[model samples]
Target chain A: MSRRAQENLVALVVLGVFIVAIVMAFDYGQRARMVPLPIALIGVVLTLWQLVWQNIRPADELNIDLLEVLTRREGEAVARNVSSNFDEQSAHQKRQAAGRESVACGMVLLLLGLVWVIGLLPGVFLFMLGYFLLSDHYSLPRALSYSLGLVVALYLLFVQGLGIALYHGWLEEWIRNL
Target chain B: MIDAIVAGLAALMTPQAMVFMFIGVIYGLVIGILPGLGGVVAMALLLPFTHGFEVAATLALLLGAHIATIWGSSVTGILFNVPGAAKSLTSCFDGYPMTKQGQATRALGASATGALLGGILGAIFLAVSIPLVRPIMLALGPSEYLMMALWGLTIIATFSEGSLMKGLIASVLGILIAFIGMDPVTATPRYTFDILYLMEGISFPVAMIGLFAVAEMMKLYVKGGSIVDRQMTEERSTVWQGVRDAFVHRWLIVRSSLLGVWIGVLPGVGATVGGLAAYAQAVQTSKTPERFGKGAVEGVIAPDATVGANEGGGLMPTLAFGIPGGEGMAILLVAFIGLGVVPGPDMLTKNLDLVFSMVWIIVIANIFVTIIGLGVAPYLARLPALHANLMVPAVLAVCFVGAYATRGQIEDVAMAVAFGILGYLMDKYHYSRANLVIGMVLAIMIERNLHLSLTLYGSDFLLERPVAAAMLAFIIVTTALPFVRRWWKRRKLAAAGGRA
Candidate 1:
């Protein structure tokens, strides 16, 4: 998607959230919804303004500054400068960045899933091992050593030292019940 | 007063208290450096062990660690753009930029000195303000507090450098997010949607960990570099330069410290607001306001000073009226009761010396933290130079575990991840995450106080309360001053161009 499209998508998502919130506010009593209702309404208005403004303006002119708007400053020049700085990257580079961002997001989700299924210590250890190996930044032996040593240290600090009962994971609990 | 001061010093001078103070400072520093663990956690963890210690020793340990964490949390925020606690969030604005500019040591130094000076000033204020504080506290009602929270909202303008509309929307979203759980005023769940965990509301630290830390790691992975550029790994400024910056901006430090103390004195207005307010004041007062949020030393100095002095301000109400100033002070009050210290007016009259001991501990603890902070700053400054491959996974691991450690709920980890994705998107867009956090911090305070003011004095509360009305006027003036100045400047330029 184009940068403008992405920006519009985010604005639309925000607008949706505010609309949903305002709709849900009706379910609450007067006191409960008083603050949230007004705030959500403001959000909806502001986001709609943003969506409309961004669509009408050129992509380069979309960097609207509240101060500039209030002061009626030379906003076009400022917006162009700001947008140009971010837009300096080539389309190819932007695509590459998007790919990397996707991978990063996937890795985070994978780590979260691992932690949920296998618990914190073991999950973190496995995630680190997998990341270190895949990233090709460390030797196999070094990755193993670093992962083991760090996990052991975490175990000592959180479990032994602090005496926190870490979540022992769904797998551990389920197996124990069986 | 002189006798009590001397007695307080004498009490704190004991070997037991001194040793415990040192240990507590160190422990607090460690906990503060870790993501999601703050002074409250540090003190809460030590609470179980507080049974057998001397009163002086126990207070020193609790208060000392709390004091040290103020600077400890700033270390992470400064170096990595990952604030260890919400209060330290302000530090990440300029501190991380300075780190990228190879001035991490200097930033660390300034932060330490600012914190040290703020702590000392706060301690002095606590000693002097004890007797005079009651009337001041009584004069300010919920209307005034609501005005203060509104004053904090004005800071959203400062963060709205890119897109004011987006900043406002982000802040509104943040306020809405704060309302997700049960409403305190009416005993009704506002937006839980049948989730049991949502009944308690989102944990601030957990949200913060995901927003800044986890999001930062993801950014690092995408960028394929360490936090600091390889070319900028060499230190550009010394720790002395940072310390000197703090002293050179002594007036700013003093103002920020006073702000911190005032915010601290106000019940429910924690250091989070104090730090942001100080930053707002700094930016507002700066001649070159554009330099802020782009590695301005004043930006680093103001927040640290405010947070440093906040503890001292926080202790006043907790000791005198038994009303805790913030969460950390609330924990301290629990420890106070455990140690047989009854906090009330008698605490001022009968236990004046003990109060002085706590003051003395703040002074001593700040000195120790500054010394240690300055010593390790050069080494700590090198952390941002690590490869992204090593740093990303490690930091993410810590962040995930820290999120879980925050409330010991597995659901918190999920919340952290969700916020992380949102944060990444927000950053990619022009939205200000700082404004959102500020909104979250002040939303409850504003709502609760508004409700109380309405109940107590009706809708015309602001008009009825002269002080709150004046404060409202002040907030309007301060909020408008920058825009007015900018407009005047632009008008002059336009006229000059036409004349030329």
Candidate 2:
């Protein structure tokens, strides 16, 4: 997606949240609805204003220097031209980042699932080892050692020192029951 | 006052008390350096151990750790652009910028020294103003707190350096998120969507870890460069230079510390507001206000100073009126009740010695933390130079674990990851995560106070409450001054150009 489209989409998400808040407020008691209703109403207005403004303004004029008026400092010209939506990167770089981000998000979700199924310590150990190896940043043996050391340190600090109860996980519970 | 001070010093001088204080200071620093583990958690963990200890020793352990964490929280903010706690968010404005410029040592030093001075000054202020603080505290009500919260919201203007409209929209969204859980006043859940975990609300620390630490790692992972650009420039400033920077900005430290103490004194305003308010004040009052949020040393110093002094201010409500000023104080109040300490107007008289003991701990703990902070800063500055590959997984793992350990719920880990993605997108889109955090911080306070103010005083509350009226006026001026000044300058520029 282009920068402008992305900006509008995000604003629309925010506007949707406000609408949800307003709808939710209607379900509550009068006293409960009192604050949320008004706040959400204002939120909707502001977000709508932002969305309309983004659409109306030309892309070149989007970078409004809000701080310049506030500071009034000399020689420290606030770079008003910097666009949040458009970075100085090639299409390939942007694509590469998006791919990496997907992989990263996937890894986090995988870790969460692993924790639920196997347990925190084992899940963490496996994730670290797998991540290091998958990234091709370290050799397999090096990944194993780093993951081992991390798990040991985590066990010592959180479990032994703080005496926090770690989650036993679904796998552990099933094994125990059997 | 002299007698109280002497008694405080004598009580804290005991071998056991001293040892506990030192240990607490060290423990607090470690917790503060870690992302998402704040002073509230530190106090909660220590609350169990406070059961059998002597009152003085217990206060030393709890208060010492609490005070140290204020500066300790600044460490990651300065070094890595990741706030260890919400209170350290303001420090990241300039602190991280300084790190990128290879002045991490200097920024850390300024933070430590500022925090040290602020803590001592705040303690002294509390001691001297004890007689005058009560009536002032008693006079303020929900109306006043609501106004103070609004004042905090005004600082969003400072953080909205990119786009004002986008900043406001982002902040409103954040405030809406804060309404997710059961309302503190009416006990009605707003937007839980029937999820069981949503009943408790989104955890602030968990959101913060996602918004800052995890999102930052994602950016680093994709960008693939050391956080510190050592090739561009060598370390330009030393740890001692940072110390000198703090000393040079002595008046700024004093002013920010007083602001912090004032915020801390108010029930539930908390250090996060104090930090942001102090940063705002620093920017507003400076000759070169634009230097702020861009590695200005004053930016680092101001927030740290406020946090340091905020500890003393927090004790006012907890000790005198039985009201917890902040989350950490709420936990400490529990410990206080467990220790058989009664908090009331009578605390000013009967438990004066114990009160003084807490003050002395703040003073002594600041000194200890500053010494340790200075000693460790140079070594800590090197952390950002590590390869992103190693740093990314390690930080992400710790962040996920920390988020889970916050309430022992894996769902929170999921929430953190979700927010992490949200935070990354926000950064990419210039949607001001700082404003979002501010909105979340103030939402409950603002909503609760607004309800109480209206119900109690009706529609004409502004006319009835002079203090609230004055605060409203202050907020108006604070909000308008920037725009008004900008307009005046633009007009002058246009006129000058026409004449030329």
Q: Among all windows of ten consecutive residues in candidate 1 chain B, which has the lowest summed lDDT?
A: B155-164
Against the true two-chain complex, what DockQ does each candidate achieve?
Answer: 0.60, 0.48
Q: For candidate 2, write residues B419-468 as lDDT tens digits.
A: 88888888777778888999999898898998899989997899989999
Q: Taking chain A of candidate 2, what TM-score results? A: 0.83
Which pairs clash (backbone N, Cα, C closer than 3 Å) in model 1? none
Q: Over the full model, what C-alpha lDDT does candidate 2 score relative to the true structure?
A: 0.84
Query: Using lDDT as the measure, which candidate wins?
Result: 1
- Model 1 per-residue lDDT tens digits across residues B152-247: 788887656467788899999999999989899998988899999999999999989988998889889988877887684667789999999999
Score candidate 1 by DockQ: 0.60
Model 1 RMSD to the real structure?
1.9
| Candidate 1: regions farther than 4 A off | A65-67, A72-91, B491-500
